[model samples]
Each structure stands twice: as structure tokens, then as C-alpha cells.
Target: MKVIKNIIFVAIVFLISIGLLVVGNGYDMYKDAISKIPLTEKVETIKEKENYTKIEEVPEIYIKAVISVEDHRFYKHNGIDIIAIGRATINDIKAMSFVEGGSTITQQLSKNIYFTQEKKITRKIAEVFMSLEIEKNYNKDEILELYLNTSYFGEGCYTVKEASRKYFGKEPKKMTDYEAIMLAGIPNAPSVYSLTKNPELAKQRQKQVINKMIEYKYLTQSEADKILEQ
Candidate 1:
């Protein structure tokens, strides 16, 4: 019994040590990234793009679709969503891999602007830190706008305006309900859902987006049906 207790204690300590090391490295990476390019400067560069579209320029349906599909609790959470993290953690454990990420919109924006796409614990932590910083400095609308502008929508479209013109040849504000929802779903897996590359897959993802919108109460079933009819 004594030996078993000792082994358990050692294991707990070892795990705690590893956790600390990971957190420390992540914090360092966050600091280094900010040092190279201040967050404000990075944001300015993006906003200064001639094609940048403000939140007001986007359709309400598109906004709702994105919030429903990407982060339903976007308006309620701070920079992080604890419930989402817990759910993702369980899913990741079950899969025995980093298969599910619970990144909030703010966190995704942070990663889009500052970090690489590679999935690593340290980078994930750094992204969290950056998210907190962004939340401190920007309002919800600003963050959402920035996220839309930075997100890739396949076909080499880097901003929402670019994607809108590339896919539909119309401004975002003029997008039909169906078009808005379809565009909202593209960012989830742009490479696979790019309308030109995979029209069928894009339609499937649009259905997923509409389902999420209904689940989140952003759209009624009838409204979704109407959108589909279009």
C-alpha cells in the first residue's frame, strides 16, 4: 500500500510539472509574438486594407449564421468559453488526439492574426493569451468584424469582401439569405467547401449552418426552409 501511494504521488507531481512547463512556454511565445508586432499595429494593418469590410456592411443573417456555427456563446463569454473548452477536452481525449478545438471567435481571430495554423499546446496557450488581450481592447462587434476580415474563404480570398465578390460577385450586404449562410459555412473548411471546388460539399455545409442557426434560435424552422427554397 505504501509503495502504491508513493507511485501515485510521484505521478501527480510529474503531471503538474509538465503542465507548468507547457504553460510557461506558451506565455513566452505570446510575449515574443507581441514584441515582434504590437497587437495594435497588426490590427491597424488589417483594417487599413482597402477591401476591409466593417460589421455593418455584412448581412445580419450572415452574422447570425457565423455566431451560431462558430461560437454560439460568443456574446456571453469573455475571451474564453469554459464550457466549450470542457466539451472539446472530452472529445479530444476520447479520440486520443487533438481532434476538437473549442476556440472562441476571439481566440480564432488571435490565431488568424498572430499565430500559425499548426496545432500545438504552446501555440494554443499563446492564442488564449492573445484572445484576452484583444477582448480587453476591442468590443464584440470589432472582434467579429476583424475575424470576418481575416478569415480565409478559399479561392485565395482572404477577406469577407474578397470572398463575397469572388463567390457571388456582390457586396456582402446584398447577399441573399441562402448566399449569406453558405458564405458563413465556407470559413469552417474553406479548402473543402469552396463553392467552385466542391459545390455539393458546400451545400452540405450550408445545411449544417442552417441547423446550427435554428438550434441557437437565430432562425425558425420555417425561416430555414424558406432560405433553402431560395
Candidate 2:
């Protein structure tokens, strides 16, 4: 019993030391990320309603579709979703890999504008800080608009308007709910799920988006099915 206690004590101390190291390095990484924020060129179009910009005129259905699919609690949480973070943490531990992420739209925008796509613990920590900063500075609508305007949809698609024109050759407001949901699904993995690159995967992801909308009570089964069918 005494030896077991000693071993446990050593293990606890070791674990604490590792955690401290991670947090310490992570804080330094956060500072570096903050430093990069000013250097990151802002997408000016996202800041204001431009006469010719589709983002400024994006429809309610498009916003709802994105919120439903990307972050169901976009309006509920602060910068981060604790429940989603916890869920992702458990799954990552179980998988022994960083398989799940609980990034919100603001966090994704933070990466899009301020950070690179380097998958690292430090990058993830930096994203958390950047997301908080974004939430402090911008409203939910602004964040969603920026994300829609700046996010990639593969096949050289750089914005929601671009994606719409690529797929349907129409403006965003004129797109049907089915089209909106399909575009909403592309940003998850643009390479694998772009409407033109891997259309089958894109369609599958669109179904998931509609299902999420139904689960969130934004749409009924009949509504989801109707959108899916068309």
C-alpha cells in the first residue's frame, strides 16, 4: 500500500508538471498568435455592406442553415462551447487522437484570417484566444457574415457568392433552401466536400445539415425531406 501510494504521488506530480509545461508554452504561443493578428490583413468586404457583395445580402435561411449545421448553440455560448469542448475532449481521448474539434464560426474565422491551418496544440490554444477576441469585438451576425464571405468552398471557391455562382449561377438570396444547405456543408472539408470536387460527399453532408436543422427544431422532418428532395 505504501509503495502504491508513492507511485501514485509521483504520477500525479509528473502529470502536473506536464500540464504546466503545456499551458506555459501554450501561453507563449497565444502571445505569438496575438502578435500576428495585426499583421493579418483583414477582409474589408466583410466589415461593411457592399452594394455588390452577396454576403451583405445573404438570406436568413442561409444563416440558419449554417448555424444549425456548424454550431447549433452559436447564439447561446460565449466564444467557446463548453459542452462541445467537453464532448470533443472525451472523444479525442478515447480515440487517442485529435479527431474531434469544437470550433465555432468565430474560431474558424480566426483561423481563416489570423492563423494558418497548422494542426497543433499551440495553434488550437491560440484559436481559443482569437475566438474570444472576435466575440468581444464583433456580433454574431458579423461573425457569420465574415465566415460566409471568407470561407473556402473548394474548386477555387472563396466566398458564398462565388460558391453560389459556381454551382447554380445565381445570387445567394435567390438560392433555394436546398442550395443554401448544400453550400453550408462545404466549409467543413472543402477539399473533400466541394460541390464540384466530390459532389457525392457534398450531397451526403447536405443531408446531415438538413437533419441537424430538423433536430434543432428549425425545420420539421417534412420540411427537411422537401428540401432534400429538391
Candidate 3:
């Protein structure tokens, strides 16, 4: 019984040590990752294509559009949305696969800034921790802007403005409803829903976004129907 108690005490200490290390050293490790592989470089190198501009330089409308569609409660939530996480958990359980990710925009930014593309449990935990840190340190608008500027969209575009130019040959501020929906849809599965490569799938995803917008009251049903018809 004494040996078992000793073992338990040792285990608790070990766990506490790991937690402290993660809290103190983990942030530096992740920040180094961001500085080393800045989003611009990652997009340029990975896609072997266009240069990316910083998020601050991008238009506000594009950022608003993205947040409106991708994460409606982006500004309201801290780092994670409990409702979204619960829904994702249920969906994952039903699918019996990693089919759903409940990551808020902050979480997505955390993963993008700190980790690689690998989908492992450790990476996910780090992402969650970093996301919470980001929420504590930054404002909602800042997080949203960063995500919009750094996130990858299909066809090698880095920022929303770049994507707008690549896809519609216009600035993001000038994007029409359909154009906005199309751009919003590509982030989920860039290669599969690329407008240049898979117009049909892109259209389907665009419709889905339009539906979501309507549901969220960003667009009226009539407006959604009109966009869908087009």
C-alpha cells in the first residue's frame, strides 16, 4: 500500500511538471514556429505561387465576409465555442472518424501559427492551449484579421484579397455574393473544391455557404435563392 501511494504521488508530480513545462516553454516553442515559418513563406513555398500581403493591409469587408460565413460567433466566443465543440464531438462519434473539427477561428489560427499540417493529438492540444493564450492576449477583431490574412485558400492564394484576384480577378472588397460564397467554400477542401479544377463541387459548396448565410440572417432567403440561381 505504501509503494502504491508513492507511485501515485510520483505520477501526480510528473503530471504537474509536464503541465508547467507546457505552460512556460510551450509558447516560446510555438512562437518560434510562427517566426520561422511565417504564413507568407508557407503559402509561397507550399503553393509555389503568389506573394501574400499582411492581414492589416487587407480590406475590412473581406474579413467581415469570412467571419460572417465561416464563424458567425467568432467575435462573441473566447478561444473555443463550447456549442461548436459539442456538435463536432457528436458528429465525430456518429461518423466514427475524425470527420468533424470544432475549432474556432482562434483555434485554427493557433494551429496555423504554431504547428505543422500533421493531425495528431499532441498538435491539437497545443493548438487549444495556444488558442486560449491568443484569446487572452488579443482582441476578437485582431484574431479574425490575422486568420483572414494568413489562412490558405485553394489555388495557391494566401490572403482573401489574393484569392479574390486569383478567382474573380477583382479585389476582395469588390467581390459579389457568389464570388464571396465561392471563396468561403474553398478553405474547407481547397484541392477538391477549387473553382478552376472542380467548378461543380465549388458551386455546391457555394450553395451551402449561401444557405448558411441565409440561416444566419446574413442573407435573406430571396437573396440566397437568387445567388443559387445564378
Which candidate gets the maximum TM-score versus the true structure? 1
Candidate 3's C-alpha runs over 4 A off are 1-65
Local error of candidate 2 at residue 21 (angstroms): 2.3
Q: Write the per-residue lDDT of candidate 3 for residues 1-230, one digit (tens) a residue.
A: 99999999999999998877766565565566657775455534534434444555555434545666677788788888889888988998899887878888888887766677676545666677778877887788667766766678877676787888898898776777667777877887889898899999988887777767767777788867786676
Model 1 clash pairs?
none
Query: Deviation in angstroms for 169 in model 1?
Result: 0.7
Residue-level lDDT tens digits of model 1 in 1-230: 99999999999999999999999999999999999999999999999998999999999999999999999999999989999999999999999999989999999999999999898999999999999999999999999999999999998888888999999999999999999999999988898997998999999999999999999999999999999999
| Tens-digit lDDT track of model 2 for 116-213 | 88877777777888788778877887677778877888877767777788899998888898898888888889988867668899899998888888
TM-score of each: 0.99, 0.89, 0.74
lDDT of each prediction vs. the true structure?
0.95, 0.80, 0.73
lDDT of 1: 0.95
Candidate 1 error regions (>4 Å):
none
| CA deviation > 4 Å runs, candidate 2 | 39-56
Clashes of 3: 0
Counting only residues 3 or more apart in sequence or on different chains, how many pairs clash (N, Cα, C under 3 Å) in candidate 2? 0
Model 2 global lDDT (CA atoms, 0 to 1)? 0.80
Model 2 residue 29 lDDT?
Answer: 72
True-vs-predicted CA distance for residue 41, candidate 1, Å: 0.3
